[model samples]
Target: MPERPILVFDVNETLLDLDALRPAFDRIFDDPGAMRLWFANLVTYSEALTLSGAYVPFTDIGGAVLRMLAATRDITISDADGAELTERFGSMPPHPEVPAALRRLRDHGFRLFTLTNNTLEVSERQLERAGVIDLFERRFSVETVRRHKPAPEVYQGVAAALEADPGDICMIACHVWDTIGAAAAGWQSALILREGNAPLDVGPQPDYIGQDLDAVADRLIERYGGRGPDRGRTMPPLLD
Candidate 1:
């Protein structure tokens, strides 16, 4: 059997339950659906900033997006409201199956890591709060490259840091744009069909697609488990 590829996970909605922030949104925007809009805009702007050669911290962009959204509806967001959103975002609980699924992947000898748009500090706080921080061997942030996902440079930077061939890495994310970016970088990809996400037809597609982390974990273990030698090896340091 071919050596199993290293698995690199995406944080945010892929592992953590983004819905945990709904209450904050409902209270602040007076519209629960506004959460989705805010998140969508946050992501859109992150990419836009990267494409335009401007970089901003993801959390700052999120805050800016929130204020922008509030302005659109002529609503007011106070300092406390912004703080509450930040707190909720940082403390989002892992999806119901996330912890176990991650453990299972590790048990199957997969080397797990994270590459997120959030800064390393925020991603650490988030995974630590989610109680799954230990599952990852390392967490990478786009801040290191000052670029965001769907930017080939972001994916390439991870591969360069790991000293691994792009083909030896698999990117697992709920966002199709993320998967597409990794695939373009010659990495394998898996897409978890989180709510408001689905497979896209007109692009490089993910190698695996599942309803959630559990389903994706099962598929990975089935495909890559029990190989003759352990291919899921320890990773090198991100910096020399």
Candidate 2:
């Protein structure tokens, strides 16, 4: 049997529904699509900053990107609107079925952790708001390592922090770049293909892929739950 790997989750968009922030965008720009544009720009700039060897908190990049996106479209946003959007993002709820899926994995003996590009304070606030904070044993952030994810150091640092071999850690995320990065770093990866996300053809494919967190959790439990010394144990049925 392959090693029973520790599960490291990506916080934003993977487990949480970023759609929750759409209303804020709608109120500001009269276009819900602004949230999507803002998010994409935030990620692009964050990665660019990382490659340039500069580090900023994810939320700060998010705010900067929101303004840049507004400028591109000639939409003026109030300071209160921007601040409200930032606050709403930090308290977005988990995607449907995520909480139960996490509990199922935890109950089946897998150790769970979060590896997010967000700072520790924001990660904690988001998870706490999502009501799944207790399901994780530890929450990791690239801020500690002074880099954002898809950067090899972020993945390696997560494994190092958990005291687990890179190969014995599984990075679960909705972003193809994240999965590809983890795979390249020698960690197992599961890609959750949530709507508006898909796999890329460019690099090593993820070891596992699913439509949502529940689907991925089912696969993980089936493959790793009752293996090894627990071979005789019966795994529980997946939650609906």
Candidate 3:
């Protein structure tokens, strides 16, 4: 059997709760759904910039997308409003089960890391605020490679940094596009079906799917826990 894979995670919406920013969206756009729209547009434009051979910082893209969204409704956003949005984004909390699930995976002997489109500074603040920063061995930002998620280069960059083969990593993320990219890079992947995300029927797909990090952790432990360097022993029960 193959050795257990190192776990590489996506931060936003995968580990952290994006809904934490909804209040800012509601106040800024006066629309309950504006946060989702702004996020979708942020991803879209980020990918567009990457594909077109232009690179912009993720936070800058986020701010630009917020402005674009505001313009759509002829709503004016002040500098203070933009700053508040940025602050809120960086302080999102982990999903309720994320901390324990992450600790469980670490306890099972799976090395953990993070790869995010957010800049290292932003991601550091995010995970630190969420109280799980200590769980990750390393955190990678696509900013280092001047690319974004769903880009093969970004995935490859992570493998290169870790000095591991792509096949040695298993990416866990909430977005299908992310898993698709990791799969293309020859990494196994698990998709967490966060409320707003669902698996796609076409193209490369994740090897596993679960409704939450806890569920995904269970699957990972079942499949690979006994296959780590200290092999052939039954895994311990998951943490409560």
lDDT digits (tens) for residues 22-74 of candidate 1: 99898887886899999999999999999999999999999999999999999
TM-score for each model: 0.93, 0.92, 0.93
Model 2 has an lDDT value of 0.88
Error of 3 at 149 (Å): 1.2
Evaluated against the true structure, the overall lDDT of model 3 is: 0.91
Which stretches of candidate 1 lie above 4 Å from their native place? 227-240
Residue 193 shift from truth in candidate 1, angstroms: 0.6
Residue 65, model 1: lDDT of 97
Per-residue alpha-carbon lDDT of candidate 3 for residues 132-211, written as tens digits (9 for 90 to 100)? 99999999999998999888999999999999999999999999889999999999999999988999999998999999
* Model 2 segments more than 4 A misplaced: 227-240
lDDT of each: 0.92, 0.88, 0.91
As a whole number from 0 to 100, the lDDT of residue 108 in candidate 2 is 76
**Candidate 2 local lDDT, 9-92, one digit each (tens):** 999999999988888888877875777788778888889999999998998898888888888889887889878887888889
Poorest stretch of ten by lDDT in candidate 2: 226-235
TM-score of 3: 0.93
* Candidate 3 ranges with C-alpha deviation above 4 Å: 227-240
Per-residue error for 172 in candidate 2, Å, reads 0.4
